[model samples]
Target: MTRRSITFRLLRALLVLLALTVTALLTASFWQQRERVSTAELVERAKAHDVRIVRDSWGVPHIFGAKDSDVAFGIGYAHAEDDYATIQDVTLAIRGRLAMSKGSEAAPGDYVVSLLNIWPSVEQRYLRDLPEDVRAVMEAYADGVNLYGAEHPDQVAPSALPFTGQDVAAGFLFKMPFFYGLDKTLKQVFEGKAELVKTPTGSNGVAVAPVRSSDGATRLLVNSHQPYTGAVAWYEAVLESDEGWHVAGGFFPGSPFMLHGHNEHLGWANTVNAPDLVDVYQLTINPDNPDQYRLDGQWRDLEQSTAWLWVKLWGPLLLPVPQTVYRSEHGPVLRTEQGDFAIRYAGMDEIRGGLQVYRLNKARNLQEWQAAMALQAVPALNYIYADERGNIGYVYNGMFPDRQAGSDWRGTLPGDRSELIWTGYLPPERTPQLWNPPSGLVFNANATPFHASEPQDDLQPADFAPSMGMQTNMTNRAQRLQETYGADRSISRDEFRTYKYDLTYSERSALVATVQQMLALDAQDDAVLQAAQAQLQQWDQRSDRPNRIGALAVLAAMPVVRASEQQLPAVDLRESLLKAAANLQQHFGRLDPEWGEVNRIMRGKEDLAIDGSYDTLRSVWGEEQPDGRLKAVAGDTYILFVEWDKQGHLSSDSIHQFGSATLDPASPHYADQLPLFVEKKTKPVWFTEAQLAGHIEREYRPGEVTLGK
Candidate 1:
């Protein structure tokens, strides 16, 4: 052939190859985006669900339905309307498909889903273990989400269609472990060694019986500290059904059940409680075979599977990355450069979490609630309960593994010994719990269960097994509760509300101790240091917005508190103080700006000064900014106050950091409640139809034009 003709043929072949590759990608994308169910079919499914969603003036959904499943459907649709993006993300994360849209940064979470065998367990037991009623609710919820996606195709991403009941079930399975810091353990293992950091994040739950109340009313504080926005952030809702599934409380993005709030007769609050529920086992790898491990004098092959993560390279293109997932007899195994470690965490292969939450939501009184608690499906959380009957209780809830008592459960154990693996959890009765204490008060501030109530009414350390690994740490919020609420003989309604929004740090708080230490520091001839110390000394240990000296003291103490929380070595407080002073002077031209001027809560164009600091009872944890301001990010996202008067009449008030439009900035409800939240005020919950009659902004059924408002 002629040289020119040969070159032309080679160029033509290359062009043809490129076209073929492009066609293949487009074809794959089309298949991934294909309609799982038509919008018409989804609407038909909605018709089967007799549910009505009523949006109150604050845009909180009050769902009325014929059955519990119908209520669940309404919850899914209403929550999706406000925060579908987060719900979609939760679904993707549970399905091990997050990397398909979020790119490489989310690959680890996707891989963890496979490595943990989350889907396999869900697929297996979602049908068998979960009862028909629970399964119906989950499936109906998924249907509602699917219906919304079908109607709003523009907002739907590829592979985001056809959310299933199993997805909802697996969400609890995957996300629950992270509540106790399993994700931190995985990160440490992946880095090289398992040097886990235990940072007990904030939340406060307090319940007071009528006996302790001056007005003869039972009170419950459902204050859960979470990020201002994300998968785990709180969304407020009120659900009612003919099947007795009435509840008014907070829910996570993808959850159908009210995580914490009040039902008609009783209500409870959840705070993150970390006991050592996760165990790491160092496996002995066989020399002859890399995939085999030594277990109980036998060479056992590690069950292996490949997790194919479809990472988004760009638009219409996905790169399939194959990662080998390993599992040992202990549980999910992670082979790292340090060693192959197997993790057996609480609620592993336990898929009945939704069932337990459903039962708890339907519980009419304390006895029924305790019966639901006995399920033990929920792995971790501190539950503070109060009801109409003047009963109050606290449970340091955990599915603590019944491990051999002699072993150091906190450290890595031998994977070779099958006997070391725990097959069951302790019964609910063995859990550290206090019911109707003589003090008429029960509370948890991410503190030890032993000191949950008055010293006399508290659970003793001797009562709980050391093998249970219950946390013994205390928090400043807990200290303040003891000083204020515990010290009070008869708390009035106003006092109860005032104490919840308490901005004063306890005299025993770490912030006070740190301030005292800072005041004692030798200025060392530095005028700036002397001035900063003087300002800190003026701190009244209050994080109120009007406090001028609090800006300097809390700013300086943040580094120490943060370091301690993250299990890092103590930061140099002197250096922190100096740096804080310099930043304050540089940004505000003074070292003592008002606390409000330094701390803010901003949403959209609205920026407002907020109260509360690092460990205060008000609890506003903020993120530092370049402008020397602390932007409130977490700690006190959702707050609920529930009360039952002597006549057994129920009432509630709640506040969210932002409004009902969780991801929609354009909506009027987006920041409508921000002012109230920043000002430490709450709107009435309007739990009953009679209360909601004059308050509703709009009402409609699912698959209607009322969405995306």
Candidate 2:
């Protein structure tokens, strides 16, 4: 989940200002030097019985197997065939061996892995904590990845061999909290390097129940705004087995279970939610002993460890970079400029993320789904759910620590007091939740949980403690959703689809506010500012291809929006406007350029002008290019629109910024969905066994399918 249901505007800006922060190039020499694995041996050891993979026309894998473990194995094999390089990169990052091949860029991530003590957490808890069935799925998936790596030595980092089940589990433990902005939090408090302009993280999720639908149907919008490429980006797949494991939706790289999507009976969408789950405690150090800290009126020895990173020095040679890490009772300690601050964030010692997701995949109804959510291993994400039973719901889910009532946990805490520490979380019922609201709708645009549904049915923020830091502000998208979706009663399925693609910025939006401020400026004294202000004032705030005002206003506010999540370089309204006007005149020979001309989507050899702006329901966040244009980099990555008809027949359609093969530019699937995405259209999702029969583009076993097939 990347969005909160409700939050305050001030905290939102500070949250943005606070933070910001992949891969080995495989070569022929690595292949030549390695002992290649035999395909026959892989076939013998994989144990993928009754596995039959049918790749749909869109090149999405629909894997079928006799057992649940077999389907997991097939998903591993199929996903590896599509994106083996990314699998290695994900696994490597988890194992803290990424620096061995990627060098300095990956070293910090490797070091964070050490600082978080993630591996030891996995080591201590993985085998013992995970249920045997879940462990089987993880182990089988890892084997599939290992088999792929064994077969294709050419495209892997040398240190990435021997892929294990822990790697798969670690990937979940590593990525879960980051999705909730843990990395951003780490950079703000620890790294001390504030990013000026960063791609923001947010998502859109809404569920419509039969009670409010015109045709008595249910709909769920699975739109997650993410970088078009990366570890957190979505990859679509359909996994099913005879053993009752059936799910289709999106998964990250190296995932065996769908992170968000639907099975036959139910489906859920995730938006990132930020509750005050992380606690920063200032440790009281011993006067004489540097390695000891005062806690509970007693000086305690800090646990010390060293992580050795094999940093790439040259070809086939890695330099060992040893980093010392310390831990106190407060958790992982960071020696900041001011003091040693320890972090006790949710999922710090988590290994059950995989299990939580697996249960969600296998859940048949809202009860099962809620039961699975009770695991509370995912830590945080805003969930919008819809089922065939005409039920629609929202859950502002988090592993909220049951901290003591006296202290201000929202701010820094006293590490010396054990009473300030929390040992458990509120039960599932205690988290903000809604079921079948009177309005029959639930939505979150990274806003507060208080406004998640119809006002009457919305969760009462007052019921929760102030220490939770639950947001109380509205995003441009959330405000717009209120104006549009909330205003609409008895929504049709077609209307639901159209509403999710709304591209208008709310009047309350920061971009619009910036423009308003520029308009209020005494621009009459400056010719350029006057001209720019006049143009922006004429804007209708629709980021469409032919809109002239959109180009100038979007560009004028682009700098600020890009850096919204971090400390911004004082962006003067008049200065920003004048610069934008100048860039427009210089780059395209006119200030009134079409929105698409300035905002574009660029892939390898495929560049096209795209529409949409940041924080819009139909969001598109662009990176400023050298030539004065903004290249679409993130926002609105994978979108899935699902509907259950009057008779309970399920149908789904989706679009991706890229294709199923996440990293392969040569594949036909790559860039295939761009036109659909840009056109505000969706491709049919073949969910049933009937849909899979003839729609397949290619079908073969993992080892049998050639690269780029």
Best by lDDT: 1
Q: List model 2 lDDT by residue over 383-492, tens digit each.
A: 99999888899888998888788788877888999988788887777888888888898999999889887788888867887767787767888888887889899898
lDDT measured at residue 650 in model 1 versus the true structure, 0 to 100: 93
Residue 24 shift from truth in candidate 1, angstroms: 7.1
Give TM per candidate: 0.95, 0.92
lDDT of 2: 0.82
lDDT of each: 0.87, 0.82
Write down the lDDT that model 1 would get.
0.87
Residue 459, candidate 2: how far off, in angstroms? 1.4
Task: Give per-residue lDDT, candidate 2, residue 14.
Answer: 63
What C-alpha lDDT, on a 0 to 100 scale, does residue 393 get in candidate 1?
93
Candidate 1 at residue 686, lDDT? 93
Task: Show how many residue pairs clash in every candidate, following the order shown.
Answer: 0, 23
Q: Which ten residues in a row are the worst by lDDT in model 2? A: 19-28
